[model samples]
Target chain A: SQKIEQNSEALNIQEGKTATLTCNYTNYSPAYLQWYRQDPGRGPVFLLLIRENEKEKRKERLKVTFDTTLKQSLFHITASQPADSATYLCALDILMDTGRRALTFGSGTRLQVQP
Target chain B: EPEVTQTPSHQVTQMGQEVILRCVPISNHLYFYWYRQILGQKVEFLVSFYNNEISEKSEIFDDQFSVERPDGSNFTLKIRSTKLEDSAMYFCASRYSPQSSYNEQFFGPGTRLTVL
Candidate 1:
């Protein structure tokens, strides 16, 4: 079975500091890896998606690095603010032999930015 | 900016009762999906609908569960007999295309279902 793990259940960091979260997976070679932000009582919002060949992707204050060889991906939120506090999830896109695609999500890492 | 929308922000139903969750995906999106998240658990995929048929479904979506896109704009998930374990947040998502470069799924606010 394919498994995706976001190791840290929760992380607390001071405002303006960089918060790095980790995602690791096994038993599958995904075509794309994605990150999403989910607030309590709300659905997840799409953040970024990096292809297998892409090493790193950046959008504003967020940066995500994918290392296929290590079967790990790192999510970084730089100069974080209190508003950036939320549960961040990493998902891998699996393309089945039937030509269908599905996203398998990690347990997610909750980040709390303290002021 | 377009977004997926779900009805009834919260639903409370008795065990063994039937419940229908409705969603209106982004107008132009071709791919629709249903996902559920139990309290403190990861989001789990239920089913994916495309071209007016089920493209894929997870094991959790058992015989008691069914999906329908009765109308062009409305997608629905129905649970024939809700169980206590069915209590969770149901989310609807849509994507414009399946192409890797344009496949970011946009999720709805989600409907909290409480089965007692």
Candidate 2:
């Protein structure tokens, strides 16, 4: 069975500091790894996706790095603010037999940006 | 930006009763999906629909579950008979054709189903 694990259950950091979250998986080599932001009681919003062949990807203040050899991904949110406080999820894209893609998610890491 | 929309933000049904969850996906999106998350648990994929047919389904999507695109816009998931374990937040998601962009999916505000 495939297993995905986020680094911690929750993280608290000060505003303007960088918050780094980790996601590790075992028993699978996914084609693409994605990150999503989920506020309490809301659906997850897509943040970024990095292909297995790509080492790192950036969008604004967010950066994601994929290390296939290590079966790990690191998600960084720099210049974090109180509004950035939310649960960050890591998901792997799975190709189904019918050629459609589905997502398998990890138990997300919740980040709380304190003032 | 067009986003997926789900009806009945919250639903409560008695055990053994049937419930239908409805979603209107983004107009131009071609792929549709259903996922559920129990309180404090990871979101789990239930099924994927494309071309008005089921493309893939997870083990949790057993005989009790069925999905249909009843019309051009509305996609539905029906639970034949709800069980206690059916309590969870159900989300509807859609994506544009893989050819156009990163197959990123847009999710709707979920429907919280409480089976008592």
A1-115, model 1: which lDDT tens digit per residue? 7789997799999999999999999998998999999999999999999999999999999999999999999999999999999999999998766777898899999999999
**TM-score, every prediction:** 0.97, 0.97
Error of 2 at A104 (Å): 0.2
lDDT of 2 by residue, A1-115 (tens): 7799998899999999999999999987789999999999999999999999999999999999999999999999999999999999999997766676679999999999999
| Alpha carbon deviation, residue B87, candidate 1 (Å) | 0.6
- Collision count for each candidate, in order: 0, 0
Per-residue error at A98 for model 1, in Å? 3.8
Chain A TM-score vs. truth, each candidate: 0.96, 0.94
- Of candidate 1 chain A, the 10-residue stretch with the lowest lDDT total is A94-103
Which sections of candidate 1 miss by over 4 Å? A97-99, B98-101
Question: What tens digits encode model 1's per-residue C-alpha lDDT throughout B9-106?
Answer: 99999999999999999999999999999999999998999899999988899999999999989999999999999999999999898554557999
**Pairs that collide, model 2:** none
What lDDT would each prediction earn against the true structure?
Answer: 0.94, 0.95
